[model samples]
Target: MSEQSVLFVEDDEALRFATVQALELAGLSVRAFAGAEAALAALPTDFDGVIVSDIRMPRIDGLQLLARVRALDKDLPVILVTGHGDVPMAVAALRDGAFDFLTKPFATDHLVAAIARALERRALVIENRRLRAALAAGETDSPLIGESAAMVRLRGAIERLATADLDVLVEGETGTGKELAALLLHRLGPRRARPFVAVDCTTLSEDGGAADLFGHAADSVAHTRLSRVGAVVASSGGTLLLDAVDDLSPAIQAALLRVIEEREVQPIGAERAEAVNLRVVATSRGDLAAAAAAGRFRGDLYHRLAITRLHLPPLREREHDRMLLFAAFVDQAREALARPDHAIGEAERHHVLAHGWPGNVRELRNYAFACVLAADDAPGEDRQDLPSRVAEFETRVIVDALRASAGNVVKAVELLGIPRKTLYYKLGRYGIDPDAFRRQGT
Candidate 1:
């Protein structure tokens, strides 16, 4: 089935057939089940669709099914339908994390609209997860790419710690790629094939935040009817990244300390604690030690999470890597936008060198794309024509290749993926002295 399809459960044969027909006519792809058991059994862990079930069913009812689905994947949208629903039941369902509730005799349009909205939200959630993973994992071999000494040391530490399986705390400023470092640790570690779940502590609210991270048992949380799995449990056998860990509420921090200490989580209202095996990677912008000492953060939690630590240097501190990263980002942007190569003019080079890049690589990458897209709009003769820009890009590429190859024309040609004669022709056209690089390196 396509990820865009839906799973629908209803016990009534006539209503099930009629609703399925209506949903199909409304251009939705749906799989109809006679009971909740069948639907629950067919559920996929990475299901990207919506679930609509009649709340008043035998054996496994809609609310029970919703609870099970939440335990499986909290983000999966479950819409409960019942002709017997009262105001309180509906309110309770919503509070219990039901996506939406519909009463029978409800208009076909109303159900369809509800399903559409649920599907839309599901798509956004899935896409956000995908994009976040991609951003953290990156499109390159190494998530952290630079030749700076700080980067080299950080990479070595990460490689060593990744295999040790110790919980790690990454300290860095915003946009310093803390998430990326956490992801690298996950990827390079034994849990590479497992889930990499990242939670933003800043967005965790006091009202239901603990339930969100630690999960809740059915009826454990007030006005809630479902048992939901939390992120900590969801990341079992993998890596749980606590981004901005210092931002966690004191209550959550205290709860998290137990999970880290015991390697088990007791769900709200649950009788037994469940054992979980996962690596925890926490990131903090501020000094967690200071926060803990000041009582702003839990001292015990910080000490537990900091079993191993990696600190990423800000962009300004990596002076040697600025131009290298800028060039790479520009190339990526040009390729993504399917545009002609962007000539790095004096203005761009100067800005790359001079700017503080408070947002680090993220800010630099955005600027690179902006420059590529706005190349034509550069003011006062700073912008060159397509041919001139292409020529300039060509020169830079050849120079870089030569530098990498130690000015060995044969090696440079191979590195550039070009014919030797073609590389020679370009080198002659651009007036680049290959021997200059050779003398400096080889």
Candidate 2:
């Protein structure tokens, strides 16, 4: 394994040289500086090393250096060396965020142990930062693919919304990429470095609501004995994506409304209110307006959320981009399967375009995966067998579309190419109840 780096700052030449030699013998890279000024000048913001320094030094002292390091990197550990009489000053350093204080004439083993712990802490911090960067990259690269006019407009809207800080309401059918859009907004927005919290309103219940969204204090009656950190607190300086806001209970809705209106959040058991700086993006598959009219949703909440509503049209309406989306999905499936590049035959492309994908891009992706798997299993099958496989594929597609479209004959006919009479016949043949597919609203 590679050696960890250590920066040792001590005014005493004998102690500094001896310490450097000891650390070097232990397979660590040591940089010795006789004063704090030299060490501070050489330190870079991205330096990954444990800092060991004597508490008493001329010109710039160890405490001053510790403060400077804290300003640059709070996670960087600083271990202070002190004499028996200087223990009081060492304790003061601890209150100022020093990692730990060591008495002089300390055992070599004790010094090595402290250095190991500090290096381990530095490693963990670096790993966390790396993971966060990877996550942000994924968000930027994996955007929704479509070329229809509606999709183009939606993309433009996202680009515009991402530049500002405002509440967003994304209205779309299930699997229409609302969450993906929210992520894009976050990655492109000013709060990109902050948290991106997602909350499912449908899953929020009174039993553990506070514990789930707002963390409990160490001492409180409703603490539940187990400390919990809520998503709202986790996403302090970023964006919060509230999925299915229509399902928010009245009480929880009121709490969320206050949070949004006041721009602050009070913990479940805390007396003080903590300020929150985040953009709110709410998504829903149902019609909020109708829900509000039916008393199923709060009118005030709906108005607050609908400040800038962007609707995602169903895939069936985006006929111009159907083939483009199909090709994209094929490429994604190929990469995922680790297969050689594959192309959709002209016939296969035509078959895909003929049907209306009611399940939207999600259904197309599933079909692509299934088709690839089937082809892999029967590598030698001729085009003569293609129709049977295609028919099976069509059946599955129709079933999913019907389920998503809720069996409305006209919508089903629009989604599937079959006539209204033929759709009803297939629904009966497939043991599907048309009434069960009907949504609450026409």
Candidate 3:
């Protein structure tokens, strides 16, 4: 996801306001202007964001702004909005390097999808430019590779909250890189040199768990005669990451709450409580508050750990990032296997992009490894990378849309944001039985 702001220039106040609101709601930072002159005045020559403008605006129009933008930065993306009569003009702007053109009265989906793709392209351009500069300076950086809007916002959120010194609660589905976000938080914060201790609650035992967390001296418990170093004490002056905190036993939760409240840990068998100066970062794939309300988790603990929360969007909801991530994973896999010739084809790209990726990044990583091996060693027709994967994904989407709309064809079309004719063609092309979904919906 691109965090770069979008510059929206439209003379129509109502359209500008509505579009701006939609874009912002879609997680874009927007700068809306009444006309080209105002937008141009505000646009810095080194602006990193994409420009979206109406072509028929008064005085200096969008094309004029596009020309000026080209003079400043030829690579800067300029998307133009055009009326029915301005199609010719909008088409001509493509020759002059306009990123894309959207017709007036286009559906919200049309505009949004276009803007998202454009921003993803803009992010690549900016990243490439940065890489060029870095290479010239003999520097290198590892970027979290994703171009989807969800990823863009995730990166932005991490950067913004990294320095805030707030205890963070990260929530996401399994394999959504919750721990990765926590690592970034620690890496980018004041505690870079400190220990980042991660404990999987699922691995904690009821017998030894509490002792492992709060530390234990010999003779404190029936488990052992030897003293133990717990995560809380071990993580002092650093961060204690609780992976899957929802699995933390209620007794442990209460103890954790005390640590947050008192800024200290009470080690078992110790006469006095020990002072602790540490940050807590906890991750959960479950609905923690609901679990607390359901008597499965502690409410006070929930509130304490949720000082600053970050939710990582699942891969299915990350849109075009699927392809981006798959490519990165493929590159990693190829490099690991010492086969630089192993590359993803267009069919594989389509399949990756269309896949639901139920297991998120982990699943994608495995698929990337599999694809690399198969494409490298397997004979022609025996390879697994094919259009069948794309077809299956398409079928799933279509079936879900049909189920969502019940037996209503028009509603299904609207749900999928596709034209009625196109929907029918896909239904026939996939040989989908929409009646099955209609019955399921009923």
Candidate 4:
């Protein structure tokens, strides 16, 4: 069964119901909307689902909705249903980024196949977005990517600690990729194949948050129809990432501490505590120790989580990694916008190195986006767009990641979000030293 969802929009109720039923019968989830307007209003910016819409709607036609969706996220897949006469318009829609167009009276099976293709594309686009975001935060699925000694030491410590199975606390400045480090730890450790769940501490409420974490029994709440199992128990035999743990309320802190201490969870309205085996990885942007010392956070809980700690290095502190990261982000932005790569001049290079990067990698990402968007808009007569200079820079970014990983092609590919075969091809194209980058005596 497909895990992805589809937003199906049609003005005709009968067609909508029939199509939605067919999709559901085909083991796909469908949310039917009466018109394009409702679908547009219901869609989220980070919608992970595909959309199927009739192009000839009464108001806010599919083409207009496609335009709006593109404005929000260019990668969103918008599949249009076109009439026999509207084939030309559908072709035009393709040029404007519609995933695919379906003609009227198409087979239900054909529609399902199209939906599958759209879902596949949607998955790739969203995954690429996530990968870039992680990279910009100075972290990767494999591990931290940096040539700096600070990063080297951090990776070494994490590697040693990953095998210990102890709960971890990751502290760093905001946007410094604390969660990514935790994810890397989980991915590299013994629980790699098990579930890795992440809960944002700040998003939970005192009343429901406790129940949400520890779960509630059936009829425990006034409205909920079924019993709930919380994060702690759900993550058994795996890992639970507590993001922004410092924001956890005192009440939640106490409840969480009890769970940590007991190694079990007593669900709301349940008579017994269920024993659980799992690892906890907590992330905090501020000083957790100070919070504990100030009595704002539970000191015992802090001690439990802080047993193993890793501090992420800020972008400015790592000289070589910053430019390497910037180039990658530039590449990301260029690819996202479907623009040619940027050609960074000496002046642009100096500017990148000189800036304070107060917001760290996030600020650098925005600057990179601005640089890419400024392609033809750059002023002065002799001003060349950044894409022109990106030919060698892209190769350099690839080489830097490869070099940092010491010729571990798999690790470099993971860091650069490129395929192993593709990187090898590029390596040959660029005449890079896959061996020279190998760590000495390794």
lDDT tens per residue, model 1, 1-442:
2348889999999999999999898999999999989998898877889999988899999889989999988889898887521435666676677887776556688788878878876775575454334444653347586768898888889899999999999999998899999999999999999999999999999988999899999988888798999999999999999999999988898899999999999988899999999999999998999999998998889999998889999999998777767777877898999988565665677798899999998999999999988885664343224455445445645666777779999987766666788877887889999899999895
Q: Which pairs, if any, clash in model 4?
A: 341-387, 342-386, 342-387, 342-390, 343-386, 343-387, 343-389, 343-390
Model 3 weakest lDDT span, ten residues long: 381-390
What lDDT would each prediction earn against the true structure? 0.83, 0.75, 0.78, 0.80
lDDT of 2 by residue, 1-442 (tens): 1356888999999988888888887778988999998898889776778899998899888899999999989878898886532434745776687876776666677688889878876774564454334434553244666655787788889989998788999988887888888888899889999989999877888767656777676655352565566788788789999988887888888888888888888877787888887799999998898998999988888898888888888777877666656666666777899876454544455667787777887887787777666666655422324334334334544555566567666776766556678767766666666676575335
Which stretches of candidate 3 lie above 4 Å from their native place?
Answer: 1-143, 379-442
How far off is residue 132 in model 3, in Å? 13
Instruction: Give each model a TM-score.
Output: 0.55, 0.53, 0.55, 0.54
- The digit string of per-residue lDDT tens for model 3 on 199-287 reads 99998887779987899888888857988888998988788899999998878888889998899888888888889988899999988
Q: Which candidate is the best by lDDT?
A: 1
Q: Cα miss at 70, model 3 (Å)?
A: 32
**Between candidates 1 and 2, which one is better according to lDDT?**
1
* Whole-model lDDT, model 4: 0.80
**Superposed Cα deviation of residue 381, candidate 1 (Å):** 3.3
